[model samples]
Target: MNTQSYMTSYEILVYTGDKRGAGTDSNVSITLFSKNGKQTGKIPLKNSNNKDPFERKQVDKFCVKGDYIGELTKLHIEHDNSGRSSGWFLDKIVVTDIFDPKTQYVATCNQWLAKDEGDRKISRDLTLHKQQTTTQKSNYYKVTVYTGNKSGAGTNSDVSLTLYGNLGEAGPMKLANQEDNFEPGKKDEFTIECQNVGELNQIFIAHNNKGLSAAWFLDSIVIEDLYAMHTYQFPCHRWLAKNEDDGKIARFLVPQSSTTETPQIRKHNQYKVTVFTGNKSGAGTDADVFITLFGNQGQTGQIKLDNEKDNFETGQKDEFIVECPAVGEINKILIEHNNKGLSSGWFLDRILIEDTQGHRTYEFPCNRWLAKDEDDKQIARYLVPRPKVKNNQYKVTVFTGNKSGAGTDADVFITLFGNQGQTGQIKLDNEKDNFETGQKDEFIVECPAVGEINKILIEHNNKGLSS
Candidate 1:
């Protein structure tokens, strides 16, 4: 009946090992932690009876008073390692709230907790454990990839496909096996385990542009979710190549159902895109150029800027038309080129996109290099409209686990992806000791607006402990 603080009581049931030397006369103590709040100080365990607790093959029970801890999650238990039989072999501990009998937490630690035994650790931090009575069912799907039958339509590059749905996206699933896959007028089939993204909305297909003939003319893709009993089709009649139709390697395609409900697929808008190559020496490239527009309504995927005459010369202004759904207002655009041709370096100056249907224009200024060995060594560039849009500062909060050794000193970074574009890997560092065990760290990242973030990538270098 110790009265330091007593809002609730927890019944601690400790199980000692059945071995001959498992008995211990050492003083045992425990600290409890719960989801709602913390419990003040640790509680000593003893009995008024003539017999000592912690006997071999015995269940020692004790009642401790502490603060109201709702639904226990973890606890700290240790012995002073003082008595003659201090080298005890502990089995497990089960804690229950006396007020709320239904709330129980079990921690299994079948190891030696003595300085002279095991890892030579005298104390143990035990987390909540539960027996798994059932297995998690995995979602499996049948993926079919169809290649177009055009002149040199086959690609020798490695292809990756990702499926997106109302549930989420799955894969960068490899689409290659043996037998020289992705041949002209051919189809490749494979089975994959992906989370059942209910009612797929789109598919993102791409290639690394490697190998000898890395140009791919993808015709269509069909996926059957065996668990959900649903089928989704993504039709693509274009080329995913660095030098082909779009000079782009990545693409996002919506399912047939989405296009069917888009009022009418024929009721699309055409956007006139004007590209100006930098006037400097070797500023122009023969590489295929592509663009994707993002606005208030939505975004259009990569569109190729193709023309009859030789385009993208020194200080050349090339114009092309792109047709898609009406993007309400102009926001930004992603411009890039395939590192093709003998001289594949190109410096882009600026871009102007005119919405023919909406009668609005958006200008994105680049004035940078998109070469493999030049400035930034990036072939792709994301530019906002003219007038130089200011950067967006996003407050990002990260929660580190509360378990043992859940903190790290490694440099952490995060990347955010949305319907518009993605942000680069921004470091998550501050003046404080961040990422401590069970710590909530907040960081402000200043970057362009990645409109409507869809995915966030979090990672850290493995230089530190328990990253």
Candidate 2:
């Protein structure tokens, strides 16, 4: 509950125990204060009058709540034994909303000791071991340390450090040497390259007095491959977007112009629509464009395209990302292009869809349907979280033919069933069922939460089907 809100509640738990001798009774009290140490409230737990060792008493349970924002609060528990011994036991203390746990700060130590306006310190404590024979691999591992002691001469006593590792089965390894050290008031760094005895998981570091004091510590027990993980370049923060215009001019759309050239597509039951106009020709025209997509059965979602509404211009190619305020299964999208007898045409290239985490949309790897839809599956579906953004829906696009693909059209759709009703289905027609050569289809579904969409099923119901 330690939040930025101007008004918040504070909760705490106080335990009290044994404040008497082996034969007398005791008493205890609890007090609460504001972050500035101002007394706010107090409560008495118990008072004893007996004098037996087994007669010593304790406070059962104490709870308190207070409004504390932009300040620190304190709790003081006291025990009084006017006629008995003088030792009190505090079992536990709990504080609520003390600090924001989600704050992103480079941790110098796994357990932060302190951080504030002028000074900060991080530390680690670990143990390393060497081999029993000299025949081992290069008896050493590289230790990299990062510090933020910039603009101040760095000192070691204030930064005590120690290294303990296994030697050739004789004794623990201690400061073989200080590879590099800097004075106080300056940015600091150090590297202790040790003999590789398999791996060194722990490297203990402390500041002040060489290694005597435990004031500052830094430890990184986890070994990570800093170079192997794949890094992705987000084309732009606005990959998937929502606009109320024709559903075209997308990150991946067909290059074309004109409503007569290609029909603009819309979701079956919702406000969502799609306009396809990003052809490889690089001409940002949409006069001859048409769009198509499978509609969910309930028809509660919306879809649209903006081939021209965005900052699209001629002779320039642009990539876009889909944005959704919710999460859902998006399985169909289609678009078409014709001159509408205008004698002018549009063209298109590739299309893709990915999740919020940037992982393209493909069902879970272990999904059973993966094998069945192998021929019509796409590797470019990425998930998005809903309700947090404006357009609370997913996005889709059409590739290949307006309503077809290599062997089957790539339209998408979904099915829904109300909480108390039976199941239903939605199908992406045109390209989804079957499309002309070289066209793509895209669509989206609003999946803000489980309450938004009861169920979703996608299919390519081509015109040739006999339902």
Candidate 3:
């Protein structure tokens, strides 16, 4: 072992040659010795052909003991002979420190080759390569915490981080300082060493009540792996309070840019709307619940909920499946009730709108009474519809089964038709392909514009065959 501070192991490359008359059955072993002539370990050399002459081996996580200097003192090679014509030749031995395995150590050999002729023993004095101490660098991580927009409402001093890695859960590592206790509208950055722990997989933020206010409005968190030069951001657009159900918010801090896209109308024309009536103290059942839908093109007229069974009642809820004739993207919604009198108004709690394709669901909250003088205000919000499934491509599975009197294989052809007409066609045996009997194959095809699939035409060259 060398005195290099970063060295923790050693590797040895042994080169053996099979020379004629070198005694093929000879066994050669190399024994390592400490400073006081004490044997540590023995490595037997497996003889290999001269064409491929190198055998690499390593001794990792090894340390010398006692009054010995941090180096291998000597190497002793022992040989035993078996009655054979071909002999073994010790070509060379290369020793290197684990930290810099390419740098070799210098050795003085007392006997270079071990053979069956006369002296059957050999020894060598090994000396490590003299080099400057190299220090191992630790990885650094920078964490930036952002407080919400509220003024003077910062996080507490007891804010900590839970880091998950290969070494298991490391800590709720404390992030505290007296000067700035994660104040609102302020950014606090903390640097941490990640050497002791393994690679980070996920992170969680824990908040406690130890500052000026117990409630901490969090905006976001940004973490940077300094050594890897990568950054991750976690959005926390919520409050962190002491009395909250959970004081910790966990998230995957992935590095990605935020993007926004215009919502698109789904293929189906039907939509489901569920309205929940509020159970407030002053709430009352109202007549004629009028709801209007707003889209990208234009707005719909007042669609009156005249059905008595579907009207909103205090502490009661109802759902309706409505069909829209307009073809555009839904962006907003408005709900109002006919307030016949002050005691006959609807206290709407929330309304859920679901697209017919089940692709998008929008929830609108209304915490006020409709048509109740001061509380009679319209509830509306902008919404973006999510796609239920990818509509661009569809998987078509083709089943090929032979009936009685039908052959074992057939050349099949298929044509698919949508609302607009024939979309695609493929011949299974256009390239002389064969669909084996009782077997199935799948193909992917691009879907036509959103509509019902009209029909499918399948033909086979072989007679009496069905697909």
How badly does each model clash, as a count of residue pairs?
0, 140, 6
For this target, which candidate reaches the highest TM-score against the unseen true structure? 1
What are the per-residue Cα lDDT tens digits for candidate 3 across 1-467? 65532313343455444444433444555665545555545656543323222212211111121222245555665555543532444544545443343345444432334444436544444543443333432456788888877864575547778664432334567876456657778888888774423334445566656655767777778877553345666666656675542343332232223232543322214566788888876565645565667776555444445445735767777887654334355666767654554466567777766653423455666666665454525422233333322345557676656755333355565656566433333454423334555656676655333356788877766543343
Model 2: lDDT to the true structure: 0.30
| lDDT at position 207, candidate 1 | 92
Q: Rate the local accuracy (lDDT) of all candidates.
A: 0.75, 0.30, 0.52
Return the lDDT, model 3, position 53: 27
Q: Which segments of candidate 1 are over 4 A away from where they belong?
A: 1-137, 258-467
lDDT of 1 by residue, 344-441 (tens): 88999988776654434557789999999998899988898865334689999999999888889988878777886655557787789999999999
Model 2 lDDT per residue over 405-465, tens place: 3445333445443353212233444334434456555655443222344665546645233
TM-score, each model? 0.33, 0.21, 0.27
Kindly provide the TM-score of model 3 when superposed on the true structure, using C-alpha atoms: 0.27
